[model samples]
Target: MTSEPAEAEPANQPADLFDLSHNVNFLLRLAHARGDLLFNEAMGDLDLTPRQAALLHAVDRCEGGNISVLTVVTGMDRGTLSEMTPRLVKRGLLDRRPAPGDGRAKSLYLTPAGDALLQLARQRTASLRERVLASMPEEYHDLFVKMLAQLVGLETETRIVHDLPTVTRRRT
Candidate 1:
């Protein structure tokens, strides 16, 4: 009897040799976690979580913003934002009101206190970012941003390709 040859695994599999994509993804997660920890530590006195800071910043930029807009801007889910919004409102950092055009939907606004906190959070975040990037040469910053943007664009394209068939079929 003749034995059939075994199929080769895909190059991008976890067991593949020298997979730079997996290595880069792992490093990205690690860096993000470390950055979050550092940012939270820096904002400890101000009592602002990173998500809260982001939400406040979004509200400051888009006054009378709806929850849908916040979800898009912050990439946070409705449930999480719902939970956080009440707390922020209670703390006088945010104002939540029913939308004038849509009574069932609510809009978010940043109070003066929220603005102040956001400014402080920006300063803290900027300081932390500078410290992290200090070892890298200034000339590399633009290049780094461009490379990261390319990676993001590629990922977005892949997502669109994967989802387009399902989305189109759903409409039919």
Candidate 2:
């Protein structure tokens, strides 16, 4: 049988050229960093990190959310959450105690001070978000939020698969 013609190789180019993966990663990093900078500046007086505000918000909804739940909800590592919990506790923004039924675990609750700070942080974050979206059309805002949610959902699914050995190793 006649051999099939060999496929032509793509032309060699600089690493920066035609590197869509790098470009996408750079764009993500820049957008997140810039947004974080703007948010921090906007909420400077609130005396809370973005994650701290999120934790307070979560605790507000859950009443007595524990570290494990917060870890799942916030997508933060246990070490980071452990580190942050005590600081928030020291700031009078949160209270941590042994869980009612689980002696091995600690539960987190937002203090009155924490609630007040979270409200302020939420207001500032909303204002900043408004300013950022001011240039975009209203219709696009809904689409943007939808796309973000989709991305987050995909990320969560990937994390879950990676975390579960049976799921990760399953045959297609």
Candidate 3:
């Protein structure tokens, strides 16, 4: 019997590009590195890293919040807070106490010094943000920020910040 012509296989691009350069994760990392450079340059007297500023900013938004909440919202591991929080306290920028509802949870509050520094950080960071978005189409700025928020929000939700193991990689 004459066989019908075999159906042609539909050609399709890969579901994910194999090249690292084309990977979204690599792109995000590259973007983060570029941002760090810009942030460091603009930080000037502030000298806070992007993550540190973000932590402080989150605390400001919380008004009076606990480490558990901060860890979830800030995407910072407890070890990170252990290192940075003490320094912030030493610098008179942060104060900690037992959470109102839960004594086991440590609550964080921004000091007047922290408030002042936050305001200045906002100003400096605004300038840097503007510079970063300068080359992008002005209309895309809102979309860019929104998209990043969506990505971060989704990623943060998936992570169980409290489930971290005790041992940390040695920094060297």
Candidate 4:
């Protein structure tokens, strides 16, 4: 007797893989823009940008992550970090202090007000994330997150590159 398997119907497969709306790049950009819009809307009351919120939250989590560490964590360039840090400090949302005995090395922390703001930002961010994921099956959220984490880096001969490293010179 023949043992060939029956062919699956076209209903189980996409008719075309090259559709622009279904393209990964297009989809990613569309989703990012939508998320950005919602995040800006939610954060407008506090006049906080996404980067500012990220920096504040990162500082809150790390008692004294230095500028270099924060640059790495927040994925912000030195120029932008320098500009934003002082503004946040001026606004009393962040504290910038010298690291222990190193007058040149500064550590960042969230002030009382920053902490409260971070809490509110966190709540809003979580709500936005939930809303975004609502279109997908709940069972796929973990897998979706995992797949996203995988797509971020480009592999090199010996390493994977995501973002530029934050470089800090050391005293001799």
**Best-matching candidate per TM-score:** 3
User: In candidate 1, what are the lDDT values of residues 56-166, reduced to their tens digit?
Assistant: 876765567777766655567889888999999999999988877789988788888987888888777767777656768988966776676566543332243334321
Off by over 4 Å in 3: 1-16, 154-172
Q: Supply every candidate's count of residue pairs whose N, Cα or C atoms clash at under 3 angstroms.
A: 0, 0, 0, 0
Q: What is the C-alpha lDDT of each candidate?
A: 0.72, 0.71, 0.73, 0.72
Q: Against the true structure, candidate 2 has what lDDT? A: 0.71
Please list the residue runs of candidate 1 whose C-alpha ends up more than 4 Å from where it truly belongs after superposition.
1-22, 145-172
Query: In model 2, where do residues sit more than 4 Å from their true spots?
Result: 1-22, 154-172
- TM, every model: 0.69, 0.73, 0.74, 0.71
- Predicted candidate 4 versus true structure: per-residue lDDT over 24-140, tens digit per residue: 777899988887787888788988988898778667655576777666555567788888999999999999888876889988878899889988988888777777788999999
Candidate 4 ranges beyond 4 A from true positions: 1-18, 153-172
Which residue pairs in model 4 clash with each other?
A: none
TM-score of 1: 0.69
lDDT of 2 by residue, 32-123 (tens): 89778887888877877778876777666555667766666566778888888899999999998788878988878878898889878877
Better of 2 and 3 by TM-score: 3
